[model samples]
Target chain A: MAEIVSLADAVAELVRDGDVVALEGFTHLIPVAAGHEIIRQRRRDLTLVRMTPDIVYDQLIGAGCARKLIFSWGGNPGVGSLHRFRDAVQNGWPEPLEIEEHSHAGMANRYVAGASGLPFAVLRGYTGTDLASVTSTIKQITCPFTGERLAAVPAINADVSIIHAQRADRAGNVQLWGLVGVQKEAVLAAKRSLVTVEEVVDELEPVDGGIVLPSWAVTRVAEVPGGAHPSYAQGYSERDNGYYAEWDPISRDRAEFEKWLERTRTTGVPA
Target chain B: MSTATTELTYTSDEMMSIAAARALSAGQRCFVGIGLPSTAANVARRSHAPDLVLIYESGALGAKPDRLPASIGDGILAETADAVVSVPEVFNYWLQPGRIDVGFLGAAQLDKFGNINTTVIGDDYANPVVRLPGAGGAPEIAASCHEVYVIVRQSKRSFVDRVDFVTSFGHGRGNGDRARLGLPGAGPTLVITDLGVYRPDEHTSELTLTALHPGVTVEQVREATGWQLRVADELARTPAPTSDELAVLRALKEAS
Candidate 1:
């Protein structure tokens, strides 16, 4: 049944230092807000994994909370002429497990490979390039007959995932109106999942036909009406853009981050 | 009309307006959003100023992406890109520090005083009508990028008198205190529309029409904007595209 626990308690209990936490959300939908609450409570050497490096990853990394990261893009495209996460490495931030953008598809396949306990996943798509590096990280093996190179990424078993959403039932059935696939992927890839909902309904509207994961995937549902702060949800509220666009310059300087820490932490709306 | 430049045989879209290209160049380092700015800046990179360090916010530095990335998440930007980064580092470290020379963005609307709101079309924020992709990193991109380059097709509705919501960042501070607030790169620099390029004056930072495309007229640009428009004194003609420039751009687009 749905319960009202302090987000602080819910997330703090699950996230550990150095854990590879996969934060769900696209450009700005269905972010791990409660988990971010855990972020504010204490700073630890954490590893955050997401598709492309954006504000959330940048904020955690810049704040010194994240020691390593896994993501794609990390800078404004043109205005600044930089890919931020890349700059972090050249500028002395810890080097992360860099993956290609298509690595998601490969990682997803690895999950199936792991669940099935298959020895390796095959590489058929792009043939060869730096992307072949995945073969190194994953156990690369060759087909004795075909003699083709294969990429075998290890199945990721996350400790737990803190997910926020628009609605969930007492039984823990969840419904996310937009951008639902990867959220399911992250949840399925993790051992446990902590959910935060905007509303707790008796049940939910019929699945949007195309929806994938069902209630069985959810572990616990925590109701936080405005959990997706700083970040934006699909139809609920728009992203606080004014805040995000201004991050580049501030994150670049350590001193500025100290000042930002004062500002955000002082007014830190207890996630 | 028929005699002079028709030999070029370029569509209005093919050759970028000079003002539009230059507006994109103002940024020493650009966190390219995608689409037009990506095209124009890459074109700018090949032709005039080779120094423009092109950063695909997707973490590709000077990545001559093969084609228009389907989205920021496309593999082209990631593969051809110089480096990969965590999503957070893009915002926390690179942009906020004022290192971003300019933010190249595409917007839904730009009100007078150069305020851009990419969130919604209707009035209500709670639950009234259409919901756009909530600001992913646009706001931070807008707020923090030292300057911004806006590439929007010309339209009266798009150049609105006011925005429903300020979904991304731009120089227009909430209470008109961007400069006063000590915000670095707190405002927009050039606006590149389908018809022409525009910039703000030295003091007011108001959007002023600067130069028109080859065939475009001042009235055509005026008709597209909702606000009262101003023109720059030295409206220059856009540069002609060389065969080499076209070939490189074509190659970049094809690799994706």
Candidate 2:
């Protein structure tokens, strides 16, 4: 059975130091609130996993919560670069962060493998690129039936997975729509999962092309309205495009990023 | 149609987008990266290829964004998409299976063989002078899409003899390379640039200038490229953007 808990309580209970944590949302429903809570609680040495690793992951890495990042791509979306991520990689500011990179196909398959309880997943990716050279997890295997060579990557099971959704029922069956990434897979693959939603209702109408995680599958549910702000929650709010444009300059300089971090730490989640 | 001599003023970037958009026929499923590729794909959908399906890396299938998507995962893409699936489904089911007809890409650096580098600028990957966003879905899209069309601004720095790092394989080493590696799909069929358009030489796998953009000189293209570029025996000047093409392209840009 899933329990309805506060965001802080959920993060404190589930996330720990040196734990592998996945906070997923493609472009929508990013769990920025939970990430902030983890930062506020000062969790360290976390191996953060996400497909894109946009502003939220940049925030987590900038706050020194991450010891390593496992991702396919890291950037500020429409903006230029993730300065803190670049700093961590190029200059080693705050701390030296390690990276395990994969293509989107490879990362997605890894999560699929995890959700399926498989040791690894095979696909026709990374055949002619340099990623296989740097990423040791990607191995070459031959198909038993056809003798065709394929790329295989191990499953990624995390200690805890966190995500934000549009809504959930009191019984903890979470429902989300619009650009669902690996949240379902990430949640199922983790030993424990915390989902933050805009509101808890009595019932959830069936969402077309949406995923519903039954109560038994989820560990905890937290009501954090506007949790995926900066990122957006479809039908609930519009994406604050202004914030993304504003973040580019704020995150560029080390002093500005530190100053912004200080305000974020004290101010709590934005409304 | 306006006479060819009557000048139509548009930026080279706009011209590149128009050229890239024109390559897609109706009802082609295009796997698009953000930036120029997204712009080109959207333009095509609005202007010529109304049925063109735009599949983004965010797992939004047949996305029809009224405005330009900021990134592959932009909210507008999902909000207006025909259907959305999980990230794994996007790669494994849609992209890896070669369902996409045209894979549209943008590159930081491109080589003679059409191999691209979006990873790093410097030779040493460890200590790169400039670290680019690593491959998102480019490797698979480049491998499995039926054909590919690259949109990039040509310059000495970007259009190089060899990329610092190979992020997406075009023709690999040469003619039989992609097949030898058992990789599927025909690698980059067209590379659209501000200077002109390039098609891979069937035998050598080297990109040759098949058409030059109107007003762009062969000398200018040569000067911009790092290597001695190969020009087609009879290079055709790409037709100027039609009035409708320009109007649709401009409106799309303004809406975004």
Candidate 3:
């Protein structure tokens, strides 16, 4: 069974320095609050993993909590470039961060392989691209059946996985819907899992196409409404598109980013 | 010198978007990349290709949005989608099986043979001059979709002779490259830019300027390109955006 705990306690217990942590959400239901808590706790040297490293990852990188990022895409969605991510890669301000990049298909397959308890996953990908050259995780394998060549990538089993969801019953069985991207696999693929939810209900009513993670599968659950602020929860809240647009300028300059970081530390929530 | 005057009501970007939108046929399943390609695909659905199935990597399949989605995973996409699956399924079942018909994409850098680079601007991957958002779904989308279309603004900086990195494979060197690599899908066949439309040569696989938007000169296109751009022997003039197209595009933009 899962433990119902406060956000701080969950982060303190589950995450540690130099642990491989994955905060996976494609666009909807991103665990921004947990990411903020990690920043507030000043965790260091962690390898942060996600498919698309949006604003939360940007904040984590800017806060100097991550030593490496394993991700596919790193942009601000409809908005332009992630200035802080650019700064780190180009200048190495707070630290010289390392990156292991892949296409979305490759990253998704890795998670699937991890969830399935497989050593690696095979796909018809990265044949003519330079990604295979740069990423050592990608290698060529021959099919025993047809003698076909294919790309194989290692499974990504994280030390801990964190995500945000719509709701969970008091028993800690989590349910989420609407563009449920890679969260289920991510949680299952980790040694431990933390889920932050909008509310804790008595029962999880059957939702169409909703994914349910049984209590035994999860490690911890915390009630944090609006946890995915700049992103969103489908029925709980709307995505604050304005904030995403506003973030571009705030994250551009080092001094401005530092001021924002200071504000986040004082307010107990990211500004 | 001869003087010619044409109505300058719509912007070049508007022309580019309309041209790109017209390329999509009704009932084609398009795997859309965000940004300019998203705008064009939406415009196509709202205007001509109403049955055009819009698939987002965020797992919204056949998404029919009233407004432009701010991001691929915008609630509007899921709320209006025919079905929603997980990201893994979107790539594995729907895309890798060659179910999608078209892959519409945008690029940070493009080469003459249509290879895309959204990974890094500089040659050094570890320390890049500009670290673009690395490949999202473009690599497989470029590989698995039956056909691929690219839309980007044309400039000397973006339209380079050789992209710094090959984030998505189009044609490796020239003819028979994709075949030699055993890639299933036909790589980038059409490229739509802010200036004009380019089609890959049937034999050489080099992008050749097939048509130019109204009021744009061949000289202007050449000045903006990095390579020795090839112009079609009989370059056709792209029709200016009709009043209807302008109205629909403007309304869509305003609504978003």
The number of the candidate with the highest lDDT is 3
Q: Rate the local accuracy (lDDT) of all candidates.
A: 0.58, 0.89, 0.94
Please give each candidate's TM-score: 0.51, 0.97, 0.98
> Candidate 2's residue-wise lDDT over A237-267, tens digit each?
7777888888888778889988878877888
Q: Order the candidates by lDDT, highest first.
A: 3, 2, 1
iRMS (Å) per candidate: 18.1, 1.1, 0.6
CA-RMSD of model 2 = 1.4
Highest DockQ model number: 3
Inter-residue clash pairs, candidate 3: none
Alpha-carbon deviation at A242 in model 3, angstroms: 1.3
Instruction: Write one digit per residue (lDDT tens) for candidate 1, span B1-256.
Output: 3355545455565555333455554337888766777777766765676677777553456565546665454445545655555343354456656677878877778866566765446775434254333344455566667777788777998887666666554545333546553445646777777687777776677777777777788888788888788788888655565556666566656754
Over 4 Å off, model 1: A1-4, A30-32, A76-88, A93-104, A111-120, A131-135, A143-148, A207-215, A229-231, B1-33, B37-256
What candidate 2 gets wrong by more than 4 Å, as runs, is A269-271, B1-6
Candidate 3 structure quality by residue, lDDT tens digits, A1-271 = 9999999999999999999999998899999999999999999999999999999888999999999999999999888888888888899978878999999999999999999999999998988999999999999999999999999999999999999999999999999999999999999999999999999999999999899999999999999999989899999999999999999998898899999999898899677
- Between the candidate structures 2 and 3, which one is better when assessed by lDDT? 3
Best by TM-score: 3
User: For model 3, how big is the iRMS in angstroms?
Assistant: 0.6
